[model samples]
Target: MRLPSKALIAILFATAALPAAAQDTAAVPQSATAAALECGDDFATWKQNLANEARTAGVGEKGLSALANATLDQKVLDRDRAQGVFSQTFTQFSERMISDYRLKHGAANLQKYGTYFAKGEQDYGVPGPVVAAFWALETDFGAVQGNFNSLNALVTLAHDCRRPDLFRPQIVPLMTLIDRNVLPADVKGAWAGEIGQTQILPSDYLARGVDGDGDGIVDLRNSPADVILTTARKIESRGWKRGEPWVQEIRVPAEMDWALTGRTNKLPLADWAKMGITNRDGSALQDNGLKAGVVLPMGRKGPAFLTYENYDVYLEWNQSATYTLTAAHLAARLAGQPAFDRGNPDAGLTGDAMKALQQKLHDKGYDVGGIDGILGTNTREAIRQEQMRLKLPVDGWPTDELLADL
Candidate 1:
């Protein structure tokens, strides 16, 4: 593992410097509108007030004009919801992210950007394949960065009730960038308003983005170097350790303690070695003096991993084991490593079964929200609550046995 480059570090730090005031107003669009309409009794006047607020926040006359002209379409909202549903499942999400297409393309990227990766490795201490894997996952090698208008998406989400406080400030920066011609007024991106090659949020881009290609403009959408380095910078900022492995496939002893799994507990390498934990190849644990935890992502029967701080660093990038696993697997493939020996068993569940489970949980007074078969946060939380209520292991996972009982 290599350290992040100074330039990349600077970019990461700058990007994370979001204004506190902006965070205060980050709400989703529809929810915001509903709140305003309810409180003010006038939707038109409420929108005007929002526009005036944008102007006061330095969105500028031109940006405000564009925003005023922009209309919220139900179709965009529907599309976003559909996409969001698709991303909820770890099994399905990981399968696509770590698919053969990504692995093949990631390997090709390593070769295409060999010099860049080599230099990045030396200068930033970030592995080349790791950087490439992030690229593959974020935007599919820049092929499908998204199609939603960046401003519209941000404004919509900000005005919506779910997370208006988090997205409110983004509107100002987005508008300011457009006003300054740093970004086009009609910039397109993911449904959540993230833009460019690395899927960076507008606020992050405004603060931390760099012209890594030295083109005098930090265009994450078009500049590979900027996107790659910016990602490396984010990893570094999250405290990725240099010269250390993120995770290692391990052979867990059949009789070994299973209580050590997850991030809750850690043991020194010496302690783990004393406890008879070894690498899959039967090698001893490294005497690196660092603490690590066991992670059985699938279950007791599945492959286990001894995860390091760098694994946590990767988690900080996406906060999902599925996303981190896909990135790690892709990185390994890019480095010519073999895929995991086992496949995901919980790969798919029929829509009907999902809906049934959702309804059961909801009937039991667990807030699964409407039984739509879409596994969003509410559904997962409800599942966890149900598991706890049933005295089952609280992994928040859905299984055939659990569904049958329900």
Candidate 2:
């Protein structure tokens, strides 16, 4: 795809060319006692403590001052919670996300930055399609990075008890970024403090940035070379294997052993082939020792994929099955795979009905995570167990009959 015009400017480091004196101009407000950043504490008190923590972490005066200006955003928490599950089926999500524009644009990006993408693969082992898929998904190739104040998003998320362990560590890194003049204090990004075109958090942004262009700076928001290489570096650091397959669409027989389905029962590709697994176009299975699992997103009858070892990286990037699977499928599409076969899967459950099912499963001593209606990994696992017990199809999708049986 053509590089979005907005990405050509160095807005990420708008202050990098300025003398260090001009950056981080905000001043930390004075406080009598540094309170611990507990969830229920007063907002003003908690903010002061946040600044204190940043200062103790060696954040410079301006970084700490910027922390002082953070506002408590209720919407950040809502957004984070809302992302607990991607309830759409694989076909639904993939069709919506992988649009004609994205398909055409992603192909263009492969040709436009062929040299850099090849170099990234040579350096980091992640292929062009994999990295570009995330680049497209995160911000639509930099066209729609969020408008949330990243500072506020970070601090707001850091204070919430639900994910303090995850967001708290990000605070120091972001302040350090601002202090280093790598990012402006008021830089806007996603609601989760993700910066740049790939929507990376400040922690990853700080540690994994790569200067792909020979400009002596790492500006992921501007340079496609930088984004391409830095994204590869990030994925590599997260355990990507070079020249290995991540996902492949596959077809499974109807009368197979249901117990061997899902990612939980990972076996060699040869074993999966023995169980009547074949490629989507009716080709032979790998017949080798690659760890393979069947992912029937809607159910046994839905679109299926044979996931490989490298597929774990997608899970690490985002835990939602729908999102990760769609991303993997989109990467394959960007690499010239045709559209997936939307099989005649059984009807899925509504959100409210799913929540009720989860509650019933919970009452039956099955750990469905929570009664939140989102079919997360734990809930899906529980449903599979119940499906096995009920002698139903063992795909993870919780059906109405599965709910009624529970």
How high is the CA lDDT of each candidate model?
0.64, 0.75
Off by over 4 Å in 1: 1-47, 83-93, 118-125, 273-276, 343-406
Range of the 10 consecutive residues with the lowest summed lDDT in candidate 2: 15-24
lDDT of 1 by residue, 1-406 (tens): 2322233222222122222224323422333344433332243654586677667666787888768766555544554344232334544445545767777778887887777677666666788888888776666778767777877776565555544554555676777778778888889876667777667766667666656777888788888877777766656655767777776677666555544455446788788788787877789877788888876555445556777777776655554455576577667667777665452344334488888888888888877656677665477667666666676655455677679767
For model 1, what is the C-alpha lDDT against the true structure? Answer: 0.64
Candidate 2 overall Cα lDDT vs. reference?
0.75
| Count of clashes, each model | 32, 2
The CA lDDT at 15 in model 2 is: 14
Instruction: Tell me the TM-score of each prediction against the true structure.
Output: 0.75, 0.88
User: Could you give candidate 2's per-residue lDDT for residues 1-406 as a string of tens digits?
Assistant: 3332333122221111111111111222222122123765777887776777678768898788788778889977766665322565677656877778788889999999999999999999999999899887777788877777988987886677765545556677888889888888998987777778887767667777888988988887788998999889878876888888998899989878877788656788888888888899898886665687888888888898888878877766776677778889999999989989999999888679988998888998988777887777888898888888899878888788887776
Model 2 ranges off by over 4 Å: 1-37, 83-85
> Total backbone clashes of model 2?
2
